[model samples]
Target: MGAGMRAARHYTLALFDALAAAGYDAPERVPRLPIVNPPLWELGHVAWFGEWFVLREASGSHPGEALGNSLLARGDDWFDSNTVPHRARWTLDLPAPGALKTYCREVQDRMLDRLAREQDLDDALYPYRLALAHEDMHGEASLYTLQTLGAAPPAALAPIGQDLLPAAVTPAQSGDGTDAAAGDIAFDGGVFLLGGDQARGFVFDNERRAAPCRVAPFAIAADLVSNADYLEFMRCGGYQNARYWSEAGRAWLMGQERSAPRYWRRDGDGGGWHELRFGRRSALDPAEPVRHVSLHEAEAYCSWAGRRLPLETEWEYAAAAGRPEFRWGRLWEWSASPFLPYEGFGADRYREYSQPWFGTRQVLRGASFATPARLRSPRFRNFFTPGRDDIFSGFRTCAP
Candidate 1:
């Protein structure tokens, strides 16, 4: 098999094996979450997506065509994400875990066979590459879903080689401050190139066609906001005070009845802090960057500190400018900008990926601990609804 096919198969099997080992095979054991998909359905969807793009669509078959000949007869009906409503997925009669695993294997075998027959591996194989990337994304999603469900960390997801284990919090070095090094790194900021350059292989649809934009002189935080920093906001009643929050933010807070960051629990006297990760609870580490906060919570914290979230352009400029002091990739940092299309924006072969969520979502720059290393790039854009706090997300601030 080719390198891309091998990688796609490896990640797909790893995720499925992990889910099965964790007792996610039974439908009753899988917890229901508004933001998460059923594990069984998700597994089949990953395989279906790969087959759709690589085997069917790449072969010039139109959308929803040739379904009867699919590796799994009902694959399209069960896993076409575009047609399958999120809520309706839980109601579907999904195949058993064992049968789903077989379907995944059959799809992988056929994809590999097709890949070997193809001559062009470069630009001609774009759809195959897209399939691999799609599977890798869902692989990360599966892990986070397990986290959201409060399941134990899967053995397949255990860190390899140099990667640190999730449970092991590294001790802060001497002279290392609990908060991000205090200061604003100032930039003269003229016209800077923004968005992805196609020259850079495998640019996502949202990041296509680099364009130059004039940016005003600005300053951004040297490091992400740490748990210690946000703790002060909570103690000062940041959540209760409406002044710190936007109109939508206030509504979300009241609807959810949230007082502190998600997964956080305070001691009876309000002096101690702890956070739940996976299925285990541990004392909150003050020096660690805060995770699992919504855009609203990040904005409120910035208001309380008299700082503001950085514009998406500024975040891009800082990362691409090669400032080693500006630490990111530890968490997905929220920006002040709303998600929108760049100049001359056009959808790629995968139309559903970026065009639909253009205006309603908030833009986030940088990657998180759970993000695949290959997917982490300075130009990559990740967006989510402002109210989403289930994923690993945090924020930094800019001078007002």
Candidate 2:
């Protein structure tokens, strides 16, 4: 098989292995969450999506192609994400774990056969690349799903061929140390080139059509907000005070009955905070960037601190400038800008990907630890609703 085909197959297998290692084989043990998918269904869908995109859609097959032409007889009915309603997935009679694994292997083998016949791995094989990128995205989703389920860390995720660092420090080891000092980076605003370059290979639809945006002079935080910094906000009743939160945020906070960040618990005497990761509770690392926070929470914290969230334009500029001190990629940082289309936005083959969530979601720049290495790009735009705190998300401050 060609290199691209080989890499795609490798990542697909790795993701499947990771799922099994994370107890996906034991469906009864996994909890049902609205934000999460049933492991069996998720795996089947990945395989089906790859086949649909590369083998059927790319090849000019009929839109209403029969599933029997592929390996699985009822694959479309079970795994087509567009056709399958989110809530109806739990009610469907999905194939057994073993059957799904077989289907995955079968679909992958067929995809490889087609890829081997192709001479070009670039533009000629865009569908294969898209399929690979899609799978990589799902791999990150699996990791976060494990986190949301409070399951143990998967063996596939352990850092390999790297020197081991010391265990994460507990709150007792560092008692509310002052927020890590950060500099305000000032930019003389001007017209800046924004969005992805399509000629550069495999740009997402949302990031297409590079355009120039004029931004005003603005100053932004050099570093992400640390756990220590957020602790003060919580202690000062940031959640209780209505003035700090937006109207929508206030409603969400009350609906969820939340006072602190998700997965955080206070010690009995209120001297320290603990965070739950992969079903294990450990003391909060004061210096680590605070994560798993919603846009609302980040905004409220910024409000209390007399700072503001950076606009998407400022963020792209900072990243493009490549200033050494402006560290990112530790967590997906939230932007104040709502997720919207660029100038002359056009949908690619994957219509549902970017168009569906345009105005309703908030944009997040930078990648998180759980994000796949291949998907890590400064130009890549990730979006989520303001109320979502389950993902690996955080934010930095900008001058108000």
Candidate 3:
């Protein structure tokens, strides 16, 4: 695994422990947050999942011995992400919290020992590292769920004040010379290194060894599209206009029964929509890239503005370009590419990180405000259902 991947694994493992220690349980005495699985379920699920592919397959172990195989998979009556949905897990009468902790410890020990013994097994490193990175990413998602549910922030988590930007005036108001200036970045696109340089370290299955890709020249906004720009779309009826939305995009829009952006509320007779950030209402920060928008919303706004969202390859092309300081602090960027594996892809030390989600979901680029900075990379791939508007997501566009 690469240094970044290892850091992610350590980071994910720590967060899961923190959630459990914080006393978030299935029947959480607290409200709003998910009935987080008792520390037992989540920890085991992560460990079991790792043990199943990494050790079992690598050593030719049997499947029956796998962790949470019965509970993690969906069964006769309903769904089980093993990630959340507390009531059912609480009903299962599974292993005690202590037992589950033991399982996670065992899995971690085995994986570490195996990794150490096979330091020379250089070929396996790629897949093994991939799986760890996969688990690490999911771990980050679980944290976002905690925030959405308003679980008290973990004491160890970095403070929230840094990225929580000040609000910007609405675009209608912004034209009067009162807005953060756009950081326009120009790119002389040509043949570029499209993925990770294996020489640099571990990379995802989809982003294998970096290879050259040719592209036409394009310019990207120096930073991501911010909340202020998106609010203008809401004010201009961007979401409501079918002319600006694709058929699938429009269908999803109508179903939401939403008029303005999600989480936005009116200020008054004269005031425009203000957003609720971490529970309190805050004026929109036009300087910050918009968050909480979906692909449909992104496309609609792109159409309305006579622009288009960048493709995943285009996003990679931009991020991988020479500029060093250009990430959108965890606010995911909408991209046009569907998620898929690269040519001649193979599993690394860890398996299934990139295999399961390929082709089923759309890809977004950039880590969010919630993402660990070390995990952010131009070639990193993030996939989600197109209709998932719940993530604090946003997008930027290339000039038409």
Candidate 4:
């Protein structure tokens, strides 16, 4: 428990440093989202979440009158999700940015200081532990915010060599003699357990109730498809082909004239294709997992590859496959299914988590390099509609 808290504290500090280095300390520099928290507002909200759930809840201590009910009362609105209207957060007049920072410091200091004495690691520390994870999610968003504005990603990430990280996927070793051929993870679909079995460990509110369900035997990719993989589809006039895409996906592609990736400039190069990332031009990483593609784009790529997107259940089965710490950090994976409430789903302490996103968005699994491990799990579901590509999301095809 102490170790977890320590990690959380370091992460919290990293978040602040990233923001400051990205120029968000000015508050005015934090971009205002039409329906999302400003980077500064988000920072404070994450801190407030820790206080409300851990520090104050444990000691029965009040965080002063001014900071009184924020963690409890306005917790959801401030830190709840992307669905909320952004213009309204500024209206909340949230503790004048500086006060938010103080609130953050106060909460962190108290939580870390008290973690040593906390005995109810299972119950008492659960909420704050969860809160710590929550903040990590927002930190990733803060990184994306920097990228979208053509500003710069955090300086911590600035030094990463322009050359791609070595490819983690080895298709030649994947029961096939070819690295370019697709791969699969055949799930012996049956009475598969859905959601987190809370008794095992800490899980988010939405993952509380686990249940048994059946799924057909299916095959999923052994690893996420790489940049080289997706480009093959584009090279074959895949985007121009209507049959490979869903109606909505085809329309979206048509609008963008996006036969290629959002950052690519095609083969204008010295013997290889070039792409843009962190606002700089560099050779595309053929071996690295493809990123920044939309669910629609993912779906289209899968179709062109003679495969289908896995159902959410299929994605989860593969993600949870081998129980290998439940992660593939190279890129986010898109599922064939849409986000929805579980069979017996209902609200909990933080009511807005997944209940609100049902019916409107597609499900994404696994985490990208930007995703914090603490905030991810086989049961932690992420959603975005197929049309959006402003964040990190990519996918692999399942066998026919």
Task: Flag the better candidate by lDDT, 2 or 3.
Answer: 2
Q: Where in model 3 is the C-alpha error above 4 Å? A: 1-24, 27-40, 53-91, 113-121, 124-128, 164-183, 267-274, 277-283, 346-351
lDDT of 1 by residue, 1-400 (tens): 2676677667766766666677776555666677888788888888888788777754322454533446776777788877788877877888888798888888888888888788764565777778877887787677677678766655655541122212222221111221233566777676767776667357787886677777777788988898999998998999999999999999999998999899898876878989887767767889888888999999999989999999998888777666656677777889999999998888887788888899999999887776666677777788999998887789999888
Q: How many residue-pair clashes does candidate 2 contain? A: 0
Q: Rank the candidates by TM-score, best first.
A: 1, 2, 4, 3
True-structure RMSD, every candidate: 5.5, 6.7, 7.6, 5.6
- In Å, residue 370's CA in model 2 sits off its true spot by 1.4
Worst 10 residues of 3 by lDDT: 169-178
Off by over 4 Å in 4: 22-24, 27-36, 55-67, 70-84, 90-99, 155-182, 254-257, 267-272, 323-327
Clashing pairs in 4: 35-86, 185-220
lDDT of 3 by residue, 338-373 (tens): 888776677553344567688888899877766655
Among all candidates shown, the one with the greatest TM-score: 1
- The digit string of per-residue lDDT tens for model 2 on 1-400 reads 2564556556555655665676665445457677788777888888888888776754322346533345677877888887888877777777887788788877788888888787664665777778788877776677678778776654655541121121121111111112233567776667767887766568888997888777777788888898999999988999999999999999999999998899898888987889987777777888888888999999999999999999988888776666666677778899999999998899877778899899999999988876655677778899989989988888999888
Quote the lDDT for 123 in model 4: 76
All candidates' lDDT scores? 0.77, 0.77, 0.62, 0.65
Predicted structure 1: lDDT: 0.77
> Model 4 RMSD to the real structure?
5.6
**Reference-based lDDT, residue 29, model 4:** 64
